[model samples]
Target: MTTTTQYPECCAKDNGDALGMNATATSPISVDGTPVAGELYTIPPRCGRAVKLKKGQVIKIINTPGSQVCDTWFFNSDDLSEFASMEHTRAFIDKIIPQPGDVLVTNQRRAIVTLLTDTSPGVHDTMIAACDLFRYSNMGITEYHDSCADNMRMALNAIGLRAREVPQPLNLWMNTPVNPDYTISWLPTVSAPGDYVEIRAERDCVAVMSACPQDIVPINGCSPKEIQFTVAG
Candidate 1:
């Protein structure tokens, strides 16, 4: 577990502005000094973990081997009804690709997570939902298989929560781009090894994250792999 004595004056300046700014304009994040002595959770491929976060604490998700995506869900620790929602987040930020300074919102239009610094390309998906058995079944693979939805459920259960309360997650590193013709392409991510995205908790929130296990698509390149999670105060 890492600890930080100070944070930036603000995450982003244009909080109320609907027009999103270029992520390149944001100040470079300097978290390399955060001690790595904190809790380090290594989430296996096709699996998930549910963890509680305190306000002002930072969570770092690392793509150890690169080109992998982490499916993430956030909920208020006090009220599960208010949770991370891609639709609500997009509506609040007015951007498809969340940047370093963006504040991730919940279905209740409340702040949940603030993306402090993204070391990767900032090309994440806000339109896709977590993969599930039903999704695989619809693709002609009726067999029971590992899925993010199931992983999330199991993780949440560990924290005394139900699967039904899970919401559409913030797809970190999954690159699905909307083209000019109103079409979208699901391409493999371009993140390199050691790439990471650090986020701050807006309020006390419980989070569930899954290393996606969809082997059918090129999303994971071939199969799912392990990811690292570091929590800093």
Candidate 2:
């Protein structure tokens, strides 16, 4: 029997659709996305969460297993259209993987967040697009699959918000290194358990983090895991 999936009302718009479900759609850190200062939260495996950070507030994301990749995005709380853009950030920082003290910029070329600390080997990816239903379909999976793109959308919907597009995420702990020939290889994360990174908000913004569920590749060690985070001034 063929079945049709019904997405949430918030996804009625053209770009707000989510191809699958996870706890991300039902769970939110807070109603308005305001996170409690210094309170730790978890984005369950294959899920995501959205948290609001005021300008100057810092968010620390922990890699509990050291093998999971967190696809993260920052959006101007006042304007969802303005979001962290990897293309613009690389131009601004002159590096593919932003290190501590580098600033992340929005598509508008405005500073959004600043990388404050990276306890890992500074191995991250700004070149890969977030996994989505189409990605899974291309891999021969006809069934619904959880995706970072969907997680980002659902996480925002849980907070009573939505974005017209799913911006390229800052894939934390994703060890896809670029070779001299400009080719990239997807490798397992090199970070140790408990490793983390901190980024300070350059402006009041909503940050969404997805515990990437790309098991088809070894980027997450072929085993997805949860991601922990905390926000503080």
How close to the true structure is residue 182 of candidate 1, measured as C-alpha lDDT?
81
Write candidate 2's Cα lDDT for 100-180 as tens digits. 999999999999999999999889999999998878777766788899999999999999998988999999999988889
lDDT of 2: 0.92
Per-residue accuracy of model 1 over 76-102 as CA lDDT, tens digit each: 887877888899889899998889899
Q: What's the true lDDT of residue 93 in model 1?
A: 91
Candidate 1 — worst ten consecutive residues by lDDT sum?
Answer: 16-25
RMSD list, candidates in order: 14.4, 3.5
Candidate 1: C-alpha lDDT: 0.74
RMSD of 2: 3.5
